[model samples]
Target: MDQQFGEQIGNNLEVYMDYLFIKSVEEDHMLRDTVDTFQQLWKIIMKLNLRKCSFRMEEGKFLWVIVIKDGFKANPEKVQAISLIPPPISLKEVQKLKARLVAINRGRDVAQNPNDTEESIWCFLCEAQLYGAAEARKQFLEVGGDPRPVMRQAYNMFKDGGDPEKLVDAFSKGRESEYFYASLYAGLYYESQNEADKAKVHIVASCNSPYGQRSDDYMASLAKVHCMCRNWEL
Candidate 1:
């Protein structure tokens, strides 16, 4: 079904399992693109459950999480459930609490840090590692502070097949001046995936960043990335 839809609509639509998302580069083309998408679906006799559908929404729930125009967020109901759980008194109850904490942290936006001090944040990062909190780890790396332990952890995670897309998404949410390390990591991930075009964009961005310009390691990595991309003008 996805193949058929892609054949018909090309880049104008995307299918994820049973869900379909229609996109257009220009606002004026949105209605036309949607109509074209529907026409292809109609030709295949694809029936959409309208109750499960929304259009032109700025924000909505998908896969049990809330997605806003800016980024993803935890579902309110899930947060409420976690909040309502009583304090743990037994081993089993402590395990349940741990599970709930993992779930809450998984859904949280990485950029929002409740901790203030470096020591506290490092403690949180260590706890995040213990719980496999990939989002937290990625965000901490992006925020850029004292880099020794955090960078080592990030390297370990990358070696263990951590998703690069999370770092890429974090890069998009960060300020330009704050994105040097995020861009570098994202570029490395894309490079590892054999995506030179995507890799070059981030690598070049990192090379131009103030932080990147000051770091010899970043400069070396940037040169290697440029060479890989066959961009000799660097």
Candidate 2:
């Protein structure tokens, strides 16, 4: 709908599914928007149910979210409903839990405020990681984040089904990166795919990362132990 009247709506509109919320600072602008929107809807042969509509209200509920001049806020009653959800027991239920988080995250648009905050975008990136690196990268970009580090790029490439050896080759053109955490991820992926030789090479490189040694991070040590247990040279 905004495609037809984007100039008119601007930031004064928010649409979700079939629901629409239109805001205007002046009474005449509100009336004009209402008339034009309704006329467009009818012209498109869509039906508007008057009984389900409210007008000229200072504040109202939209999809359980309360909207007012001060801006939108969550409906406590709906939040209480969510809190009553039972604990998940199985992997499928765990997946369900993640899906529920995605639903809860719909309360705000991460792309709307790229400069102010990114809690919502990071939350998305966390869940998207399960899907693969492409999904994760898209969420990262929505908040103006760059997915750059050599190892980070390599990990994302491998996770999205690119070959492990190809990653090392690609990043080695100008420079080489121990890629710490990212190399571990790529190594794990290679190991899972039965490419043990490729996994050992990357994991050993990860074992030598200066950042990991300085931080004394447990995962870095764990990677070393894993290589030892497998009898792979480090």
Candidate 3:
């Protein structure tokens, strides 16, 4: 960023790898700086997808943590997912539970707006923890038995040597939403099996597809966030 805008606008930006954060206190300042930043990037032939771009957001997620006007806090959705699981009994389940717990770390201290009232739920999902949580949820559903299995079918397609490319081909033609979503979960299953190449292909396939790029759903950002957190190729 400094290489482009130099000191004039550099201090207001918080960039971590490819995640660029532009901060401004006043509304007018935000508007002016945002335009300036874009114009500068455009000169270099760099462009941002306006659909994926968020502006004037009072609250949102950054680095997997919830960001409010005051400061950052843990994501409640993840906490809810983890909390939903019953205590593990089997040794394997216990290990799985421990892995999930280890992923939640509330160590960062952002002083911009301190909140004494905030509950420290704390975390960002690593690729392992992300898929592990899915695995746990899958087990939770399969415990007694699923007479009609949606989650099982989704999780097993790759696990059982099903062709992901064929699934992508079929889903892509059926519905734009289905294609993106199916590919995302398919990537997770591949990742769990240590199939990085397959995982990357599926993960990339999950995003920027016809429907995903056009949809207003929050999951559209999931693939990018997943890649960023895991250092996977985007």
TM-scores for every candidate against the unseen true structure: 0.35, 0.43, 0.38
Q: How do these models rank on lDDT, best leading?
A: 2, 3, 1
TM value for model 3: 0.38
lDDT of 3 at 177: 76
Best by lDDT: 2
Residues 41-95, candidate 2: write the lDDT tens digits: 7777888677887889878887547777777787787678678878889865776
Q: Name the candidate, 1 or 3, with the larger TM-score value.
A: 3
lDDT of 1 by residue, 161-190 (tens): 566556656555565534665666666556
Better of 1 and 2 by TM-score: 2
Candidate 1, poorest ten consecutive residues by summed lDDT:
107-116
Off by over 4 Å in 1: 1-17, 23-26, 89-91, 98-234
Q: lDDT for model 3, on a 0 to 1 scale?
A: 0.57
Steric overlap count per candidate: 0, 0, 0
As for model 2, its CA RMSD to the true structure in angstroms is: 8.8
Inter-residue clash pairs, candidate 2: none
> Which candidate number maximizes TM-score?
2
**Candidate 3, after superposition: displacement of residue 228 in Å?**
34
TM-score rank order: 2, 3, 1
